[model samples]
Target: DQEGRIVFSNPASHRIWDGVGIEELGQYRGWRAETGEPIAPDQWPAVRAVRHGETTLNQLVRIQGSDGSEKTLLNSALPIRRADGEILGAIVLNQDVTEREASDAALRQSQEDLQHSRQLDAVGQLAGGIAHDFNNLLTGVLSYCDLLLQELGPGDPLRSDIEQIRHAGKRAAMLTRQLLAFSRRQILQPKVLSLNSVVEGLEPMLRRLLGTGVSLAVELDPALAPVMADPGQLEQVMVNLVVNARDAMPQGGQVTISTANRELDIAQAGGIPAGAYAVLTVRDTGVGMPPSTRARVFEPFFTTKEPGKGTGLGLSSVYGIVEQSGGRITVESAPGEGATFTIYLRRHAGPEGAQAKKEQRKVLPLGTETILLVEDETAVRNSARRLLERHGYTVLEARHGMDALRLLEESGRNVDLVLTDVVMPEMDGRELVQRLRAERPEHKVIYMSGYTEQAITSGGVLPPRTAFLEKPFTVDQLMRLVREVLDE
Candidate 1:
């Protein structure tokens, strides 16, 4: 008993120190759990207790058993002595708490994820609400600029001033577009596409963009499944991720973009439901973000860059685009360990097909046909009427769908195209089109909207074969879409 060797051990202790017999426990190895530093042989709890008459209680330590299995333990030790204070041996106790600690960590992560999701949703609602109104104002400002520039000939000295004003409006329009994206209100034309194909196409451009400082590595699964998403938006997502990774490594590093087909159960899916998914991951071998930075990484306008260096909308839009396409994005990083961002998109169930490419026609041919323009905002409607009339089109105006019906009936359905806002006070454009279709099945209608979240997005895409125009549409966009729809 006076010796320092472990003479006996219980059955439970043997299991906790798997593969290490009772005789070998005195030489058992462990490290301090908090710092991952080794616990020295001479400074071990039992050794310290027997040698220095010290006591150790409930110390958190991590141990790797003889079988190479790692576990967490709560350890305690006290020196054994006789009545004359003679130093004897030492007693040690350990309770394996590996599973309990892991469970607690998972619970904490779930709670934090839930809270973060709620905050994003609330902010998204606010962003969506204001973005619509901003689009309305931008349309008026930009359309007026288009009108002024049209009247000014090449010799006009005032042309440049109006051009500057037009340029500012366009910049403001881009900001609103990004805001709509972050709010999940921007329109998308999603279709079944191959994730692997997208990555392969970007490989060349990504390499050129990364330059000599950073190397690009692509790992694509041969059996990767198809996913339904807006190809352009998804490409933008990849570009943003690569750019982010590139920025993290200033001197030199490797940026890896990988894709795989993964099947996850409920436990593995985290917040998403159990299903088949297409996973895209971007990992960089560079300095990584801390937990505090990772928590707000997806937030709109949350950037770590110095002032005026970034807009901070890159990751936020990435978050929105993924969510709108019924996917989820997760990021993992620790300081100095590099960062990995993973996106999971649901597998497409329908027959896989590529998006059809449409040929572009830049001609903005003048229209001679009669048209009906409906908009609740007086400024937007008047601006549109003036723009059309200048191009030789006879324009009829209405504030709502009911008024449009009266005007159309009075004209004996002679209008070439009924252009109306999708969101209106009395009757929406869809309802008006329904009634008009019953009366005259050949009537042509074009729908326009600023508040698009509730109106335009039908399962994250537009209705089939629909001619639609987003708000703040530029002069060329308005003209081209009008001519294109009328011809169709």
Candidate 2:
């Protein structure tokens, strides 16, 4: 027994070893748990304990049973000595801790995922704030350019320069829209419509964008249900998905777009409520994403593309649009196995509706109504005043809400409309509107801001029926909106 041989094994040990005796265990095969190398007989904890009078504790090891089954063991061994310190035999203990180790690993991964999600949210908020302020500045620049272009004749040398300035401003405005989308603050006009129809209309454009190297396939279920979503934003989501799929398949592969109606149970729906959904999937047969990249695919400003090739906001915008529309998006991928993006929008039970009609350009209407414009930004305020004055409206400008209120009081509620920013110091547009309505119950108000309606008033400061304007508006937009509000 002192020669590192087991003299007796407990019934528990025998059961764990599949009824094998100590002799069979001595010949059993095993490996180091941390490294898959064979465990030498002399290097075993039990052997070391007896031969060298050493004590080994919590040495993780992998063992193979007589039936060729494997198990992970946390092993410990201690030398058994006589009263005179003479070497006797050794005692060993082993515990199956495989499940506990796996549980710990899962907890760590969840923590890491939560941390990443928080970081992404922080970045998105910062981007949204910057974009809001930038939109205000762009509004001033673009509005002034519009006024300049109107004053200039066709043959004027500076007309082209002003046009270029307008073009740049529009591009910047698009970028700001992307930022707002990623922040989940973009205003959406959701309607109940068939998702299949939206996909059908975009097939031609998608094919052309994917080019000849890639084959496009659309598998739309005719019975797919209608979903409540903004058609334009959904189109953007599809375009972004297709573009990403195309980029993934540089050497040429098939891109498939499919839609179906699904009924999800609580277990299947994840965060969303169990309900019927219109499910859309875009899949590619090209290089896919690794786990690390897939984990951060929807994070803003995170991109794997070369510099200047991507802005890294495509997937983020898609994420925002889906979330804002009360839908959910998920991606599945493995390296070299391609990728698939699945979007689920709640099925609308209401009556199906057609896409909202786009406003048609018509004769620009002029107004003689006295309007009070309150804005914190000087440039934006001046630009609005100039635009209104050129449209034959009496423009009364104030730097903020309180100043506007004072002006309104002095004017004895003679102003026809109060156009004010939703966010301002001293008093916000919401409070100012309350004061104005108290004075003149029939007064009209239009809440305007560079920030998204959701960001400015998540508490419902602006009612659903309130007239609101997004900043960076063209002169035509301003005039038309003002005329519309004044007429109403």
Candidate 3:
């Protein structure tokens, strides 16, 4: 006892040191829990109490029994002195807190991840709002550019200038679309689909994009659950991640695309609600990201690449696409350890007919049907009308839904199709459609909007059968969609 040795142990202590030999009890092995360093002999609580006639207060420690079962414990030791003040050995008490500590750590990480997600959402909202307004302005700019370019004769200097203007507008439109995506304001046409099939479809294209320097491997979980998401957008997310990985390793590396089913509780949900999730993991053995870069990797226009090499919307758009599809995304990376991007999408148990891919559709040429165009923005309305009229359609203009209704009722069967903006003052497109269908239930409608993050949710941006036309559409896009909707 005077030699700082454990003479005996109680049943409670025996359970904790179960696999440890009685002879080995004389040398208790432990470490400082916080620092993860072995507890020095001088710093051993029981030894200090027994040899120096001291008392050791609660200390957090990591201990492993002979069986190698490690545990975190709150340990304390006190000198066992008799009534005459002669010290005996000492008594040590340790409270196991391994599970509790792990839970606390998980909670801390979840909170941090949630806070980061909110910050990114705030930035996304601002970007989306700006892009929404810009989309309207660009609609007018691009449409007028299209009209001017068409009027200009070939080999004319003005044609080239107009083409340049058109080119610049197209670029701006692309950037705005990315911003809308990040903001989750862009309209989505979600369908129940399998991630495995999606990965299989894109494998060939992804391989070509990665070049010979990068090896692509896909691991699909046979029991993967279906998720409701836009197949095209999911492809975009995969493409962005693959490109990001490829860029990180300019020389050579391995990229793995995998899918699995994940069940998460709120404590481990990675900023989303607890439930069954369809997980898609993209891992790359490439130059990894530091904490600083990892923090802002999903931020719009934030890039680590040299100037002209990147626009920084790649990951941001990916983040938005997943989030808008009711999913959570997380990234793990260290400077030299490479990076792993994990996306958790809500599992869908829709009908058995859930498609592995969207059906192929036949597109149409320019139209000749009479159409009603209802838009609140005068410039956008005029630009659209001019474009439609030039394509041989009789375009009727309306300032709002009320005006469109008045024009439509007066024109009767003369108006062949109704194309309206979703966000209009004093009777929106949905209400206008309701009024139109009240008289003629068979009438068709197409709703267009710059951003539908706040306004649209139901399928097809309306009920089951309605079509959507996104703003800042190209001349060809407008013509093609109008013809298709009319034919349907």
What TM-score fits each model?
0.88, 0.76, 0.87
Every candidate's lDDT: 0.83, 0.83, 0.82
* Cα lDDT of model 3 by residue, 1-488, tens digit: 66655567778676776634323554556889888899765766766777688787889988776567788888898888989988877788868788999888888887888798899889988997888788888888888887887788898889988888889989998888888878887667787889998899899999999999899988999989888888888998999999999999987999999999998765354676788989999999988999999988999999999999999998999998888877878899999888999999989987423554334345436677888899999888988898888878888889888988887678775677888888889888878888888887877777777876645765324464567777788777787777767777
- Compose the digit string of candidate 2's lDDT tens values, residues 44-117: 78777777888999998888866787777898989999999877988888788767866775667667756866
Ordered list by TM-score, greatest first: 1, 3, 2
- Output the better candidate (1/2) by TM-score: 1
Model 1 quality (TM-score): 0.88
Clashes of 2: 0
Per-candidate RMSD, Å: 3.1, 5.6, 3.6
Q: Candidates ranked by lDDT, best first?
A: 1, 2, 3
Question: What's model 2's lDDT at 68?
Answer: 80
Judged by lDDT against the true structure, how good is candidate 3? 0.82
